[model samples]
Target: MTTLSQSGGRRLIDLVPHIVLIVGVLIFAFPIYVTLIGSTWDSATIGRGNLPLTPGGEALVNYGQAWSESHGARASYTPVRVMLLNSLVMALTIALGKIAISIISAYAVAFFRFPFRMAFFWMIFITLMLPVEVRIIPTYKVVADLGLIDSYAGLTIPLIASATATLLFRQFFLTIPDELVEAAKIDGAGALRFFVDVVLPLSKTNIAALFVILFIYGWNQYLWPLLITNSADMETIVIGITKMIGTGEAANDWNLIMATTVLAMLPPIAVVVLMQRWFVKGLVDSEK
Candidate 1:
């Protein structure tokens, strides 16, 4: 009876946090739910605050109009589609480049001990403390000098190296056993072969987690892209979305705006959901 009571008490303790978390999740998600529902209505109805709990007739019509007019009032270009593609290309390029560079850099740092090793690592770590906003001016100048402004290189090249990814991979690599490295070396495996066959195989989870993080970061980039990209063809999804909201004299089309917002969010949401298993596994492995 005492053991049974103890088990029950333990179960209750575990349940308490989950219950609280679910309530908190609901609180946060309610607004997004409202926005999604609001997207299905006509702008006038949304402006009038007559948004229904359930979506009605206005969803398809507003979505169609939003898709059609996303470029501008003149409707010369489809801004949404262009911006979507730009964001995807930029995000994927950055994610892949960062991962490639970080994996190599991190493996070197984690596995090799050379002169001024700690100093080099510390210098790299220091970059993490400097905000990207602080470096924007110099970055812009460099991009302008290289004629990368208003080009894909301007959007993707500067962000190819990520301090966070390097640090995350370094931590994970440090946790791996030295015996494995020694064994690989004894088997005539060079550094490249060891890294490719041993380290990378073990780092699948970490790589997946990093990919998701960097992808989201690149996708949500607005200020930098806005600063660099002069052409409408070069604008990202986030920048396009902000421009969709009109100024004071102009009437804002809330329905179309909300619909575009919803569509813009779908990719990141899908990415996270699809990779959730790997994300969770990465967290577990990191803990181990």
Candidate 2:
């Protein structure tokens, strides 16, 4: 009877956490739901304080107007298309670069021993404590000197080396058995060969998780891109959206702004949802 009661209590504890999580999810999701419904309405209707319950078949018209006005209103260029392509290029470059550098660096640190090894590791790890806001001005100057401003390189290169990626890969690498490396060496396998054949195969979950994270980070970067990009042609979706919202004394198109915001969020949401399985697997593997 005591054992049964203990199990019941433990189960109830677990149930409490799950119930709390569900409530939190709903609370966060409410704004997104509101925005989605608001995207289908015009400024006048939304201003009347009507909660976006149903789109009432106005979705098409709202989307069309938002796209046309924010983009090339007179057939010059589509803001959505341009900003999307810019975001894709920037996000993919940063994600791939961060992953590549992080994997190589983490593998080296984890497997090889050399002078200043701990120092080097600590130096990199310490970078994580410093926020990007502190270094933005210097970073901007460096990029400007390199003539990367208003270019893809300017947008992507500065974001390539992430301390977080290095830390994550290092933790994942530590979880790998040393015996595997020894076995590879016994078979006359070189470092590159071992990494390619053994380490990478086991790291799929970690890599997938890292890719999703870095992709989201790169995709959502706004301040850096805004500061560096002087041309509308070079602006990202977030910047374009901000421009739409307008400053004081300028009329803000709330309906179009909301519509664009919803559209801008689609790619990230799709990525998370699609890769959710891998993300869960990564977390589980990390715990193990």
lDDT of 1 by residue, 1-288 (tens): 999999999999999999999999999998889879888877667778767889867788767766655443322334466778999999999999999999899998998889988788888899999999999999999999999999999999998988888888898888888888789989999998999898888989888988888899999998889899988889888987787674332466777677778888988999899999997788776443
Checking candidate 2 for backbone clashes, the offending pairs are: 71-79
**How many collisions per candidate?**
0, 1
After the best TM-score superposition of candidate 1, give how far the Cα of residue 213 lies from its true spot, in angstroms.
1.2
- For candidate 2, write residues 1-288 as lDDT tens digits: 999999999999989989999999999998988888887776667667775587645677767776655442222233666787888899889999999999999999999999999799899999988899998999999999999999999999998998888888888889878787788999999989999998898888888888898899999999899989998788788888877765422355566667778888988888899999998798776443
Give the worst 10-residue stretch by lDDT in candidate 1. Answer: 70-79
Native-to-model Cα distance after best TM-score fit, residue 225 in candidate 1, in Å: 0.9
lDDT value for model 1 = 0.83
Summed over model 1, clashes come to 0
Q: Any idea how many clashes model 2 has?
A: 1
* RMSD list, candidates in order: 3.1, 3.5
